[model samples]
Target: MAVTGISANRLELLQIANAVAQEKNIDREIVIEALEEAIQKGAKSRYGAHHDIRARIDPKTGELALTRHVTIVEDDWMPEDELEEFNDSAMVRLTDASKRDPEAVVGKEYVEDLPPFEFGRVQTQMARQVITGKVREAERANQYEEFKDRVGEIVNGTVKRVEYGNTIVDLGRGEGIMRRDQSIPREVFNIGDRIRTYIYDVRPEAKGPQIMLSRAHPGFMAKLFAQEVPEVYDGVIEIRAAARDAGSRAKMAVLSNDSSIDPVGACVGMRGSRVQAVVAELQGEKIDIIQWNPDEPTFIVNALAPAEVSKVVLDEEADRVEVVVPDEQLSLAIGRRGQNVRLASQLTGWQIDIITESQDSERRQREFSERTTLFQEALDVDEVIAQLLVTEGFATVEDLAFVDNYEVAEIEGFDEDTAEELQARARDFLERQAAILDAKRVELGVEDGVMAVPGVTGAIAVALGEGGVKTVEDLADLATDEIRGGYEMKNGERVKVPGVLESFNLAQEDAELLILQARVAAGWIDASELPQPPEPEYEEEGELAEGEYDPEAVFEDVAPEAAADDAEVAEGDLEPTRDA
Candidate 1:
């Protein structure tokens, strides 16, 4: 009867471990380990705190084993902390252990079986805390492992609770949090409500793994479309980009791999059934589905739908575009509070400046007048000749001076002699201007070494000198932003801080190159440390020469043709042939 009672008690222990492992969704081995640790702690209390007690449980059978061990060490062995005395109960010097066993060596442990004992109230409490703590640690580890690789995935969860404005969601295997900013505006969830969210991030924290969930993330909308649209899920149509004004409006750019299918039409679905489902999930947020184009300007045009764009001028260096629309379409192009343009900018990854046709015309005329006046004064040409040169795309005296003489001679009503006279005047003017700038640079106390740096022109040297960057060392110390201009917030308003070379309109890359060159000239960095430009890729064999391949020129030639094709398609006369 006593044997039967002992067998039942051991079976009950196994049953408890199994149940806890199953309930916590942790490994059975981890649970068993926790139990062993708890039993070991209780044994130490039962015997003596100075004893080195350990416990093990047979996973295959309901059996517990407790033991006390003393490890043999060298005679010079000391405690882990040099300041502390050695623990004789847990560790024995080899000389002492050899007296008991002649063959005893360092790391050899003498073990003794420990008799099972009932736990006192204090011991019971300590064991319970130990078990709870170990089990919780195991649960956290399991949770982190389960969800760490699940970022960028959409998840459905029950609303567990709300604290402040944040919602705690009970995912089946883990808990996720949707902070107030992550939740869609005006969206609310009650406890026990089922909600869908995107797992944007998962972080392992001291307390537990934090699964950060969001409904406002653009990825959430893209994933929803992937769920509602079979083509999106099957990869027949790919969502290239998405942007959201959350609960108000959103835009998605999609491309179809198969030419027969229109990406926008497929996403819109049959009578908007598919998009309607997504809209319902998002609490009636309006979605704009547009076809993606490899041509960035064309894509930007598509992104800014429901309004017409007359022209788009892109500055690739700045990732900025100037968009011109009809005067009557300005309001529609910009949308309420600039939301349309803002979403378009986000979708197309460009800074967009929308202007009316009249505004663009006025600005163009002002620029033309300024350039004509510049040519007339710099090259000493008459108004008609200057205007003609400006019309022929000669904006600077340097362009007129260094261009192939044939290009200028080929201009209407211009001969070789006239072109030669213009080139000669342009060169003489540039030389005089350089002399003036050099004199100004000297007057401003700029070092000649600053001018000697690569990429530093005489005008730039004078400009830097005026800005107090007179020496190569001073220029080297300047940041890219100090040369390229940037914006800063002042009293809650963003204000543009003009750079030293702001008038030169230097690109960020160019500014960085200039500073690096200055650093090299100042002996601050080696010339070899400068970043090398990537080698231009060429078509195979005889298609094109390596040095002749200019991507910007290629894109420029293709953009107008692409834009024309887009117009023909809008007119229902042509079909797009570009690949997905």
Candidate 2:
């Protein structure tokens, strides 16, 4: 039989605890507590199962103590019926406990000392198991704390083991795992291979800390450049943005604090040394080091380097850009599979629509004709007046109706009187359009609950009604992803379907508010000062409950002015109360 391996002298327990803590890289207090619990487990095994055995290890001298503890309780606190079944070993009444020690009080613990027992095989084995389990738990906790905040940082490690495609890297203090998908495309790992990776996430699992590593993440490329290029590390060169397509290609935009040093060249190094190093590490992935400019168009031009842009049109409100490039450079600007323009879009943080010069010219003419047709039919104007209105950027009747008097007067041939006359016509046209939409909404059976959604226009409400979400509860039931294009099965395979909001081209923030309003309307959510749905109709003893819901009564709490404010197209001072 195996004998206990613990030292004979009790004072050596403290020395053993300190060594275990150092070896596990955990706290000494935690190790000492583990030792005490391990010893207590052994005492419990040696003593009877119901005995209240305890153990303590002194922090200073490391002296060991063992005892049987019982708690003193007031008998008056117990119920009268079950007092006979009270546990004598676990608890003693204050009256009985005070005879042993006159100072004994309720809630105080009384201890009886026990002689130290020999470490038999069973008791020693139980203690060893308890110590191992507790120490392992403390080590896991300490490891999680050490590396949880080190996410997005570059860490170097040696491949301790490779299981299939996954790599377990020994990162000095603790092991970090690099999953197969997180690695750069086609990159292979081997046991004993040294690797550097970016810490992407540190998920705390029930068992222990899960350190997720990634080389394909955009931050990895940025950190690599920072390591290779001195200027970037020192803040002389700032990396404005970075985008990665993994081991295929990557783009980095850099700006220089010193006017003399070209940021692009500084990152490129002497004859392509600095970037080439990063490229080799990334398995020959190409890197584009572009000079950064604060001007958006200028930045876009730099980002799309080697491709000349002829013209650029920006729709700021829409967060979109139309870039017109020379016809010959069209294919070059839009690289293999549109990679160049795609990276430029990511680097610029804009939705880019790249078009050839001829394509843009054609689109402009098409838009002008469409706007001209809209103005002619809506305002009952002649072709000449309609063309002029279209040329002045009055795309919709609502735009013309809401224009400042001075704005329309500034349009080439229109005076203040003509502007006012045009404005009045526009407002009249919109009111008629609104009336038509109201009739259409009724035809579609859109509920008042759908209409009350803040950002939902008449067209959006119609779309929702036609899509079979005609009630407030129906709209509220939709998930955010469902409202912003979600996956569905089509032709026996999963595919993404366009959402109702996609057809209306509603802003994301507006879509969120509409959902919130729908939830509020359905009584699923509450907002301060906003309308709330009526209480559920419960049947009373003598009276029957109302069978149908009336939204007017449901939203009776909403202010009349607030309801009218959202219904009107224009807000506050801009509302067209009169003919204009």
Candidate 3:
């Protein structure tokens, strides 16, 4: 094989390049290009940085050519100060060039063949680095291009080794990493163990290709079911959503287009054989096949199966569900370490709060009593009218006041006169409440920009003021979640203080818009400007900064006043309570 040697041995260089290209699975031309670069680099180092030198490899016969050239100049083309820095070989007068090449003209150049360079230790090392670097780069490029399209596919490989608790798998084409957390919990694998993993991500890195593999990923389970069940593979049964705890339990919500086919049963297969196969592969992770339902309440009930949900109440505005079950089934519904409810929440994409039947009844009664009392106090009505109002979906004075008179007249037992009277009273009560809230807002020193925010009703403004959100600047600094619900700091914990959501009944969208408006008002972002791309992720080092790098560290000494605008609120802080 030809190596990167002198002219006699240069004929074999093409053989060396071919061997490298085959071994690295790269183009043979790429190897030749690397060799040319390496030779040129060695020549430059042996000569000088300013010398114009080039090396080329013969494509057919593996011959080598090394050349140095100089332009024959009629006049100086550069400034005198810069001209002094130019090398003598860079340009020569036609008179002097004729001494070397008698046919050389003013516009033309003189060329000389360079002698074969002896490969010195340092020069050889540099050449090797250049060649190796180009080869590795080409290999990484091949790896990236080969696997980028394979993401989300189940791949088969053999476990190569374990390092830092992560398993490295040698796929036939490339290597992949299964992060410890991405692997099934407590599942062990030895070197040479055959493994099937979900290629969840393919990221290009400075070092090489990063093929992220996962056995615990929900996609893995879904792919397994697809592979094991022909119905799923053929698209008879569609997997809607999947949630997994990895080696413990998983829930897969599926739907079938054909009315005759039962999606869950199809996924379960004959006597659970198919699911058991997936389970064995997952190290005994129990699988739940659930039928997808269009109705969210029905879906919630289905997701909380086995324990049998008795009732499901959804707060669509909050995207939260309250599920009530039999008292004995509470633990079962919640599962060990709340795994069942957690996976259920993930499957349904709604925050799930599990409660017992008895607790549900108590909560209903408490809400009923609170609304009734609020109606009686705010409208100056009797308990009968209050009860009617509560039963008719009038939860607050704001609700009654903001409602149209026709809506009030729609009450079963109420006539137009009575509706008008009730509405007048409700309006008056709201005006009084607003005046009080305005005073409190002013007294508490709320900023106008925060108050002007759409979701910051007079009462919510009072709450924000009390929470130290005193300026538009403060509001702008808050996260979108903070604007919706205030958070609180207690015992060095976030504690998730409620914000405008409860007080103003703001939706998540409302919070986002309100925060955006605040950002514009406080000059955080322009009203017409689109949000900028987020900064890239960076690693943090403790020794890099002398002090104050820890985000949570500041929370240790944070006083009530130091809490950010969206950063402080105890539960129910934003809930309206009528007090002068």
Candidate 4:
């Protein structure tokens, strides 16, 4: 603070620089540079604004030097800044300088030392302001450098203050902010109270680096467990996934590398000591430590614990799982306000739809009735024959039309002749349906080129035309979300936007394939440039034994022939034919 004038004692200047640097936790060299700039600005005011004044401070002795510079330039030289006109005090023309000194050349600087002067009131204030601003900038830079790489770390601090529900934390070296949304609900921190937070993010801004802190973050809980559980900290156990409905409940999935160690029990500890420590830090929030399973369905079932899942049906293509529980457990499975299912979905990375056993049975019966009715009407068969076909998993007319005659003939109480007759009727019905859909597509202004796309059938063409995508180019321009239905925010509410192919029940990948094929047919891309499906990864042998549960067996229940039938049906309800 003894920066009264450039003529101040040399030791006093160094002492001031050292004090400010130490107090602000910045480099001494930075403080000296700041002082030099302040002196330069004061000198400019004292001499003349047009003069090129420079100041330097010797680091060891803190000796101040002030000088005026005049640079020799070409006769036709233009100022680098267009707004700055030529200054005779700062620059001398090369020809004029050559006349004054025979050896004078362009780019040469002439320096003249000036006597130092004491600071006047106005100059002292200006110097103080400049030094303060520069020192503040240095301090910000140092703080950013210190904390930027410390993200994802848990740190302890004191509550500095609160503004509008946001708590400012006073870290030992830098400050951090815990926004209201990032704090546990009902938690309060008065000034000077001790607190702990996770550094989720650190961002540099015009004001300063924003050190973002959070107590509600899943990482905060994970790190606290790591700190309390020696196995977690030592990497013997790993926290695979964590989901939180902060201050109410949380679900954590943990796995162990060592086969003998039970990850869940280890995390629970004796008498719930380990988990209790973490729960205490989290304001007594309930924590469910479940063992992680490599199988997604099993993991999801584990995630929905204490409710007891009766069954889980997975649609891997859509990354959705349907869970059926007992009627008594419906509310428990869904939790209060759907919190249990929401946290389970988050922890397992799947969309879950929970249904009671009665609902599942009702849905199954409805689907069977619908399929039986379709077969009965399409094949002109009796209720017995239609019910038999529906029971055999013949989902659509297209399936019966394309299935091998031998497979149908092998059915109970059926022969080759009956199988041949049923398939003939099935094909005839598909042909008639295709004709009707084709006529509708034409009426809707669908182009022939759209039918040429590899995956497009008459039914899909009609649907696309009805959706105002009549041409292949139009289909090519559409996004997958437009083909597969999705929700969109409209007027502060989420509204369902029906897809052009939503009725077809196409998987996300199937919708993507339709667009890619359209793009190829429309000359937007070459078929050769299309992405090839990845080759199946080869797992290690000797992994599975007889009667063992294989995660991949979820899809194995559907026979290969039935799967193909269902896949073809999903492509389009109508049979494949070259004729549009």
Candidate 5:
């Protein structure tokens, strides 16, 4: 056999493999494997043989060779049996035997020298197809491996194509997908446009590497700052948190490990160059860079940039903050449709409730006036009468309502008849007030029901009267059990108190609710202080017999008519004294 065509010597093949590896930035071994596979396929197709074949290359010399595999069989076996043993199914057995002892096996694999035959036109075309296909597959796999670890890094890419508003980016070695949802609103991209995006994700697919890139992610802002400011990438400054409304506004909270470095100033850059670069990338999306603080109020104030905060009322328990701004700056602080406050809340991880000075002042005044009106209404008196009662140590309506008519009349310059009239009027007024409260309950959509008996005690009644608990229905809804359970302080210390609900004679439900309200108003109890109530004991026999009721009084003497009449006269005399 004679050789034909260009002879690819060992040195030439090594040079070719090295060049391919360098150009594609792939391993030399991978390229060599690809080339050997291509040559084996081409040789098989040219020879038109149906046998197992594999190819290998010498690492030192880059010498490529192909071997055909056959199975071992007995010498006495028939030609048909030998052919069957040498078929594809028995190739592995033959190869194993050849590895152990090449001379002992008759149908085992052997180094056969084939002629360096010239290929026909069709065979040459087939060889070219195989080589090209293998090279392409290896290149794709190499590219995927290179880019998989590069996720979350910033990359500059050129727009290769646009389909359904998605920008296909040419990242040199591979392609990246920039979906419409990952882009900022109102931002446009054209074919061949060069842009910078963050590699948000990387996934391997059958076709090639799938790189998901984005510009709208909150982390993208932090990454941009890191690129622009050296302090952020180093240990000096750290981006604590970031929030974005994409295209409209964004907020970032940063902290500095080094005391000398100002986190905000570092991110801002000299003359605003660092932040300006980020803004330019975002199509001028507004960014408010603030210093992260352990104090929530200070952090929130900083988050709401371009607006000065007069005061911050923090509700630490609820994770809420009420920001008080000047009357003139209310709109500025709140921004268009509350965007500023909303972004600030997101940045600080706290619910921000914005209020103006005028609004807060008006709210306080209204609450004070309502308290005064409630006191007067509760005492069943006019404003003047209520004021006088207050001056006489009856500060609350409960105090005045519980006082007797004789005691009211004993005050200086108060006539007896006038006092009686006033007492009657006060009782009538109490009834009317109760009716009004019931009406208010109806108006406010409270459930209609009878008040429970257990919820009506002196202290509870007073609390109810002060808190506008005028109706029996209100008493039934209170939670007496919780108030009875008491509460604990922030220091984990238990508070000593009679039941808040029991004082008002509230029923189980009413007492519990009232206690909850008290806890809310006073801020004395955490959620852990509440206790579950025990199940009530049920009585089977509802009533006691007359004989059974008198076990302790079984030997007492009964009174006669003359004695009873005398007793009644004495009681009547005593009633007049109480009345006077």
Candidate 6:
């Protein structure tokens, strides 16, 4: 066959392979393989099977070269005999081929040069197919390599196509998918529009690398901050936490290594330029930049910024924070639909309950108030009396009912017979009060029915009762001064009783018991049982001299005289003493 014009060259093929490798960013070997396949297909179409043909091009010159296969056979019935005879001289006889292969069989193969095959349209068409397919494969590989390392980074691209609500972005080198779920809601895009997104994921697919982009992920905010904040990029500010309700709001907590630099201000930039840029990218989603705080209370306060926090109480064991805010700021602190507090909780990994200042104050007042208000609809006088008795340090009405007549007489304005008669009434009151208090306790589900009485001194107990130290538990809740004042009572025109403080010479344990009794009486304790007070010691006195009158006689003359008419005092006629 005669050689055709513009013959393909090996050197040109090498140069084309190098250029393709560089242009496509693929291995040279890939281009080389494509070249070889193209050449083989072209050669097959150019030359018929009559000649065993192979093609080669000169590496230095633009020249095509070809080779043909010739067979050496000893007999006419050889494999070469089956081919259409080109010419009898084309086949080499066994005798002449013996020098090359002494053991040559009936059928033998050898290579010889043939004239370069002519370039034809059929061969060119075949080569084009091979080259196109190979180049496409190389381009896909190059695209994959270009984007694999870029996953989780932000990128800008033009909208190439939209299908099924997804946007296919043209990233110059490859296509990236912005799925419907990842796209901002209510956003519309047309071809040729420029868009920015986070490279959320990259995966190798059967055809190419699948590049996925997102605008909805929480990390997108972090990435945006990294891009806009120099401190973040330089490692001076670190994003400690982030939370987002995509297309609506996002919160980011940042910490700074340099004390002089404020992490929040750094991220916010001058006049809020930096964060505004991120918000613009997110399609008007709001951004909150907060300073990260190790103290949970401080962190919560920062998280709920712009609205002031009056107080934050943390229940560490419960992982919850109770935040108090001014009544006027409560709605602002809680935000619209609780968005502010929700984001703050998410940012700080805590459950936050917001309470208004008025609510808090009312709750505290209810807790520490001295008077107990019985529900008017549920009123029972016996119940009231029972509680009053318990408040007076008697755990059970039995203690009150067992008081002797003399003891009752000491209570003020009762004669011996009247005291006895009142005792009988006291028994009935005790039974009724006990039943009512126990029922009320059960109704209220009070686990600790009542606090034990604090084992305080008699003087202290008397003072506590008169001073409104009503319950054993109440005594416990009182401050030291309150407890000390409770022990001193008025004596006629003067207040002069030894209180717990005056009994300091007692043993430490005894003194503590006295304070404990005050605490119990204050209703600070819940247990019914209490430690008993120590027995009083008795000291015998020596006999006085014959002329010395008893010391008791000195104050006897001052005692008030009994009513000459023996008039009975009314049960409810007790009046406030002048000394009191």
Q: In model 6, which runs have C-alpha deviations exceeding 4 angstroms?
A: 1-29, 41-123, 294-338, 341-580
Displacement of residue 174 (Cα, Å) in model 2 is 1.2
Q: What lDDT does model 6 reach?
A: 0.66
Q: What C-alpha lDDT does candidate 2 achieve relative to the native structure?
A: 0.78
The better candidate by TM-score, 1 or 5, is 1
Q: What lDDT would each prediction earn against the true structure?
A: 0.84, 0.78, 0.79, 0.87, 0.66, 0.66
lDDT of 4 by residue, 1-580 (tens): 5368888889989999999989999999988988998889889999988999999999998788899999999999987897978889999999999988999989999999999999888888888889899988988898899999999899999999999999999999889999999999999999999999999999999899899999999999999999999999999999999999999899999999999999999999999999999999999999999988887777888999978987787877788888889999999999999999999999999999999988877777777778878998999876566766776667889889999999887766566777788899999999999999999999999999999998899989999999999999999999999998899999999999999999999987788888998899888899997779889999888864422234332222223232233211112122212212
Error of 5 at 79 (Å): 24
TM-score of each: 0.86, 0.80, 0.79, 0.86, 0.52, 0.47
Misplaced by over 4 Å in model 3 are 1-4, 9-11, 69-111, 442-453, 467-508, 518-580
For residues 1-580, what per-residue lDDT tens digits would candidate 2 score against the true structure?
1215333466678788888888888889988888888777777777775678888878898788888989989967565585455667878998998888889988999789878877788887877777888888987888789889899799999999988788899998888988888899788888889899999899888888999998988889999999999999999999989888888878899999999989999999999999999999899999988888776777777778768886566666578887879899999999888888898889899888888977766766777678778888887766566666665556788989998999987855456777788899899988887788877888988887688777677777788877777888888888666677778889999998878667666666556767888888788877764545569988555532222112112112222232222121122222222222
- Clash pairs, model 1 backbone: none
Best by lDDT: 4
True-structure RMSD, every candidate: 9.4, 13.6, 13.2, 6.5, 19.9, 25.4
Candidate 1, residues 1-580: lDDT per residue as tens digits? 0011212377777787889888988888887887788778777877888889998888888788888999998999757886777788888999988898989999999999977777767777877788788889998998999899899999989999999999999999889999999998999899999999999999999999999999999999999999999999999999999999999999999999999999999999999999999999888999999988887778888899988987777877789988889999999999999999999999999999998978876776676678779988987766666666676677678999999999997865566777788898899999999999999999999999998999999999999998999899999999988987899999999999989999998887899999999899989899999999989988566553321222223122211232322111112211223334
- Cα distance off (Å), candidate 4, residue 181: 2.3
CA lDDT, candidate 6, residue 576: 17
Q: Residue 334's C-alpha lDDT in candidate 4?
A: 97
Task: State, as a TM-score between 0 and 1, how close model 3 is to the true structure.
Answer: 0.79
Error of 6 at 109 (Å): 12
Per-residue lDDT for 301-407 in model 5, tens only?
A: 78887898776777654577787789888889999988998888888888988888777767654543454466566544444443333334443444445678777
Query: Hey, what RMSD does candidate 3 come out at?
Result: 13.2
